[model samples]
Target: MTQATNDQFLLAARPVGMPKDSDWQRATPALAELADGEVRVKILYISLDPAMRGWMNDARSYVRPVAIGEVMRAGGVGVVVESKSPKFAVGAHVMGVMGVQRYWQGPAEDKGAMLAQVDPAIAPLPAWLNALGMPGMTAYFGLIEVGQPKAGETVVVSGAAGAVGMTVGQVAKHLGCRVVGIAGGEDKCRFVVEELGFDACIDYKAGPVHAGLKQHCPQGVDVYFDNVGGEILDAVLTRINMKARIVICGAISQYNATEAVKGPANYLALLVNRARMEGMLVTDYAARYPEGVATLARWMKEGSFKNREHIVEGFETFPSTLNMLFKGENLGKLVLKVADA
Candidate 1:
């Protein structure tokens, strides 16, 4: 193959609030020759996630901060355009932390690379970034392992229209639980209930979450999957039944907050209810990804599960497109299309 160029977004500066264009710098660098056990992947679709906002802060977290001038950390699906590794063929499609770049050239075994081949035949390329990727894995393990909802119980998910939240609610329904979702708009709430088959969806933008929870969950909540933290989590806390399980999956509401993150004030409710609130990271269940993917895939094949993705065309829209998440502009999974597969 001929020499290639890689266009990328680098972390220029950390943001105090919501990220802006000034926080990122774009560059087109010439790709280096692949070494032994190395591969060059042409990124197709980049997964725009709420966790990315936390990754930008110059603070301690599960993953290291994206250093200045380094490619912005992002998970994406791509095709191996060039390869020197026997594990990957040049035409194979793959997914990993390929960064906010047009091309990714690195060692196949690089810890930072986290490369894995994905088959478009199993699901659409964009679906891999949404329901079948990290978000799906998060929903599966967080709900199943942490929340542990049984049949006849009630499961409530905040950010219910989002990638992870949508999956959580649907999976809970499949397990014979009553699923309710809390989202920002009537359209989103309608999508979760009408399109996604959620038992009910509370439009937090329309009214108070506490009231919605009280009305829909008269029996109280047996399991709560929290994607947006702050008031929603607090509201859910007040309605939790005895031995309730709360899975803290994310805090998208607090991701772009200028002030320190607000925690739930209803902590005493947990004590009074004998409930447990636990946090989960999808990476911890990396070893069992195949298991999770297979189960989610089966549901999709059976038409019992559905995935919705709001894809934005153009790599240039990275900054603004990502802001769509915090603003609740996108209906489902927010994805950035870099190139066609």
Candidate 2:
């Protein structure tokens, strides 16, 4: 076969607030031949997540910051075109931390790469990046393991129309809980309620979240799966049930703040309610990904769950496409399609 040219976006600089095109340096590097235990993959879809903004910061966090000149960190689904590893064969479809690139060439057991083969028959390739990918795992584990909602309880999820929030509400509904979503705009709220089958979705842009919660979650929130923190978290804290569980999944609202990230001002409510708030990193449950994948995929197949993706085509649209997340422009999971399966 002829040699492949790899186009990738490297971290050029860390931004103080929202990242811009200047923060990334695009480069086309010559692909190297696959060595033993290595494979070359043609990345198909790259996941656009809110957590990516945090990764661009220089400060310490769950994972190290994306180093300058290194490939911008991202999770993607791809197809293996060449393989020198027994674990992966040629023509296999896989997903991993392939980054904002056209291809991923790496060792089979590279922990940072986190490579794994995926089946399209189970769900479409983009769905693998949505419901069967990191976002789904984040929603499943964050809600089930951290939020710990019981049947007949009230569960509230911020960023309700986004990837993690959508899955969190759906999973809560499947477990027989009353699910309420908090999102911006009327259309997103409608999608969360009508399309995703949430009990109700509060349009934060239209009115106060506290009023919405009082109207929809009359019983008080037993479990709150927080994705977009800040004011929304403070609003939910005021209405949490006694001994409630609050899951800190992501804080998209504060990710692009130029100043210090805002903390929930109503945190004292947690103490008054005897509630607990805990943060979760999806990678923390990597060993049990199969459990989350199996459960979510089965629900998808059984017609009880649905996965949606807003795919922006083109390899060069990564920067603008990524900004869509913070702008509340995309419905469901936002992904960038670089190649066909």
Candidate 3:
């Protein structure tokens, strides 16, 4: 056994709109030794999500903001190399909010509370943290608890081809709802419908979303799973059926707004239709995560749930890989490979 050190990506500055290269700093330091009830892990993959943008700002949120100069907060998969804990043995593969680094040192209690041992047989290590992970849970609870879709109803999801939105549509279809997705491009729209099993997919970049929705969802939307708010939210609002439910998941469209978030101009439709719209934080359903994970894993095994990942090659690409979310360059869950182990 020998001592080792690692490199980490640290937050340097908060961005006003879109994050830039200067907003991040890379630093190397000696890895700390494992203490009592602690373990040292070699991080393998880091999850890149839209919510990471909100974490960069200094403001009140469901979770604390990532402080300046700290290693940027992220979820990742890792292999334990050293363990002084009874629960986790060396060579174990686990997933947690491990930050953007090549190595992690934390108490076994901390890992036990926030992390889970991964089964590579269920799906790949990265897929568990992506499709079967937080994004999957977000889609599951957001639709079931918040949107409340019913059979024969029309369900619409914005940001349709992305991680959460894509999962939402697929789940809706599985529950016997007619699913329509709103994505940015034709290729993504094709993947959403042809690959992910949505009934229809609208290309927001190609034409008017309002018209597209009208064409696909002529019967009116029963459950609206909104992942990209702003104009698309307003457009969906106009088409809600009476007693429709709107699940306010993530609003990737407004995440980087330099200006104040604008309210939906068509909210009056909610009043007229007596529809309900509510925001949700996945952590709010923490107690029921195992239930969700069990169902998701079953779906994955049965070939009902599809897990997609767009993985970058190295830890050094963390900052740039994150920007891909805002640019709509990724087709599925985005992950950064930090190390080989």
**Per-prediction TM-score:** 0.98, 0.98, 0.97
List, in order, the clash count of every candidate structure. Answer: 0, 0, 0
Arranged by lDDT with the best first, the candidates are 1, 2, 3
lDDT tens per residue, model 2, 266-316: 999888999999999998898999999999999999999999999999999
**lDDT of residue 99 for candidate 1:** 95
Higher-lDDT candidate of 1 and 2: 1
Model 2 misplaced regions, further than 4 Å: none
Off by over 4 Å in 3: 1-3, 111-113
Candidate 3, 222-264: lDDT as tens digits: 9999998899999999999999999998789899899999789
In candidate 1, what residue range of length 10 has the lowest lDDT sum? Answer: 1-10
Residue pairs whose backbone atoms clash in candidate 2 = none
C-alpha RMSD between model 2 and the true structure: 0.9
The CA-based lDDT of model 3 is what? 0.88
